[model samples]
Target: MDPLAALRRPDDPACDVYLTGTVFLDIIFTGLDAAPVRGTESWARGMGSSPGGVANMAAALARLGLRTSLAAAFGDDMYGDYCRDSLERGEGIDLSMSHTVPGWHSPVTVSMAYEGERTMVSHGHVAPPRDPALEGDRECPPRARACVASLVPGEPQEWVATAAGRGSLVFAGVGWDDSGRWDLAALPELGHCEAFLPNAAEAMRYTRTECPLRAARALAERVPLAVVTLGADGAYVADGRTGETARVPAIAVEALDTTGAGDVFTAGFLTGTLAGWPLEDRLAFAGLTAALSVQEFGGSLSAPGWPEVGAWYEGVRQYTLSPEAAAAAGQDPEALRRYAFLDALLPRCGRPGPLRRAVPTIGFRRA
Candidate 1:
């Protein structure tokens, strides 16, 4: 009857899933601008830190009420310390597989967004071809009802391969541009993944695809299930079983940072799958989960918990915008809310005015 007994399979009482990937300290900055005022610095705003990438995804999945086992690596430093402690203290994550790399500085990222869009500038002191290993009492995979891989760069894909090899159902979605450009080499990585969900940009950037559906197809060839996130345009899922792709409509809601919406979607899908929901229901749940995410800043914080998501799903109009409001705002009202949230949570370029000056704060910074 012990929860740990169900760590690998659904019937097991504790039914927990394990997440293995690279964990980093996300030092996110909201408003970043270095517009040259002929030697005078412009007014700047500051935003602090939050978890990112696989770590953020793990925390999100845990918040969905699953007892998750995390197998991730971070450099032995303050960043690493913070990452480890924070995840360990989460409601449902198990830290048996998390580890620390000696002496290396943990990874960090900074983002500055305007309007409804954003530009991410990152820093990676960690190099490529990394095989992150988890030690101690982590000898076995948590008997999970499902498994997910973040496939972020520096995280060896084989770790997920090992998870798949162990009779676990696998879901994969690459993280950031750091996972490297998609190519024939990435094909091998995709072979073992079950659900390959990447945004249209990531699909086009890594996997060769001229269109969103084509991206889904290319991903389908490697993995049976594929979903391509299309912002407000909604998403398309490859349905090999139905002989065509399924268009999952976007759930209407206010958006903020879209930063980790894809990760939030993946969590929703995995959670739904484990709960025995049908594929259509799974996508809708995921769609709404992501739709609500952009209404706030950061990843896990942006992702609404099940109760909040349920409220939005139940026609909670508090966050939904109106057509008249969208027209009045000259942009989607939700998008406007999202921009304001970004302004408060991230740094900004400057206030808007008739006599204008807008400088992108992110592209100038180095990753």
Candidate 2:
């Protein structure tokens, strides 16, 4: 069956996992300093916008070959309308049960800060139900296989859950992207899902533990699996099954924009897992998707499709190794260096290098 056809099927093999999350219109500016332009230096580049947040994640998941759907809320503004149109017409993402509010502008994101390390300033779009923020009418799907519970600063996560209940696998992001503020109420409940994806810092914030290991452990106590993205350190995977822990290295790449890399990682990881790909391949797929995400601007305007991600991984010789594999292959020069580690491990640099390895459970610590 066409993966997306699942959107029409509410029963078994529901179209590529259903993603119910937030959808926002994103505005990105380039060549501008995050710092204020004080005196004579007027500016560098202007501004451009794209659909982001849960919208970006949904789009990323769609690129990875999922028959995707978004249950989100958007303002009834022109930009919100454009955002919904793109989700349906341009990307073919399903958008049923989305709410739309009038008067307020759809959510917008401004990408500021420096290269590698950047930040965004955003305004909320979650108004009362009166605002028309969703892709109305025929966009709603009968069901979805998975959902993305994204808690924007003021947005409530309860509403982001897939209406499919136990049938829908839930994935959530614990962050605000800009100020790092978020909803703690969703964390404990988030533990009930099949998996959880939160960046390293967000993980730290979630569990109130600066140590990623402790954070993962604390989170796992509530859920079965938690994928903690450690920026440059790679990612730590804590599995409730088999009681194993593993660290997967990031693909090496020179990154221009770090925007949307984590969301890209989650997209690839979920796509792979739903396809029944194993943990090892899933991690590599996550990294590969992130590498492709940075190559473009507007968050994910130029994300790589599934085949492209896999090809890129093999081209870079990006493959996970057993502890024995690492021991037998010896080492390369770049693998030994500190700054080189940053390229693969640092959030600023994009891809992460190998920090450690394991047999089955790749505990998401360090990386």
Candidate 3:
């Protein structure tokens, strides 16, 4: 089936995806040879700033040509305006479900990249006021085909339930708990969700499993679909309804920074899943998307468009046909098998034109 066919509905339903969560002004310092030592000043070879968190996923989905809408609170400040404008103008995301707080300060995060990984420090209010409807102030969330959000502690997260009640697929993810508690008690909150996605460590810690596959199965028992991302190992997914499971290996690339790779993976998965792709195809596409993202520096700004994805598919296709090239590519059999599905899909998928350039804006001062 043609992936784009699912999105040709003419009826207005607000958006293809409704993403609500934190949005951070991410100041990324890359090209660092080592992790910053405490109380020491270090120089970065490259620097960039862009929206993070839900914005990362939103921009990715929007770039993939999804009619994405973001619903979250923004501070009454320049940072907030910058984010709002960048997402709308730069990525074509809809902000109708979003709002601005009268005096809140926009959140910010400082990320230092080194050795293909990143360490970040963020400052923001927890549970920043969401759309009033999300807080039970109105009837329902803005209608969409899917709703993406994080799991909230100590609350039922009525928005997920409301969105599901209104016939939207709810894709739920969780954040890391610094307390090292690795609580699985909150897993029940996802009962109303259609899918639960978490990175490998979080999934293992929560499920008390030593492997991602076991953790994915444990999580699959709760939600209709479960996905556990294994960083360099790629991703494992299970469908509870069909009792099927699959693993897609990661694409090989010289990774620069792993900052929002997982979120980008989710966006890619969302694109294929929403478009009715097969399970293995969804995982392969998401894995390829993330592998391409880490080759760049910025967080959401580094997401690949369909054109990039198609180009990569074409490159891989040619590489596999030539014995010497395939040997040099060094892709595992599983990864090659997963990506092989793209060989046929790209021809039918329309190319995405050049991305809109992000408007330069000064970020909030970091201490």
Best by lDDT: 3
The C-alpha lDDT values of all candidates are 0.62, 0.61, 0.79
Worst 10 residues of 2 by lDDT: 354-363
Error of 1 at 257 (Å): 1.9
How many Å off is the CA of 11 in candidate 1?
4.9
**Cα lDDT over the full model 2:** 0.61
**TM-score for each model:** 0.71, 0.72, 0.89
Sequence-dependent TM-score of model 3: 0.89
Ranking, TM-score, top scorer first: 3, 2, 1
Ten residues in sequence with the least summed lDDT for candidate 3: 356-365
On residues 129-244, what C-alpha lDDT tens digit does candidate 3 reach at each position?
A: 55445455443477788888787544467678788888788887888866677776755568788888999988898889998899999988888889999877879999999989
Ranking by lDDT: 3, 1, 2
lDDT of 1 by residue, 29-131 (tens): 4443543246675453544355676776786776666677876677777767766756775344687655566777778776654455666767776534334
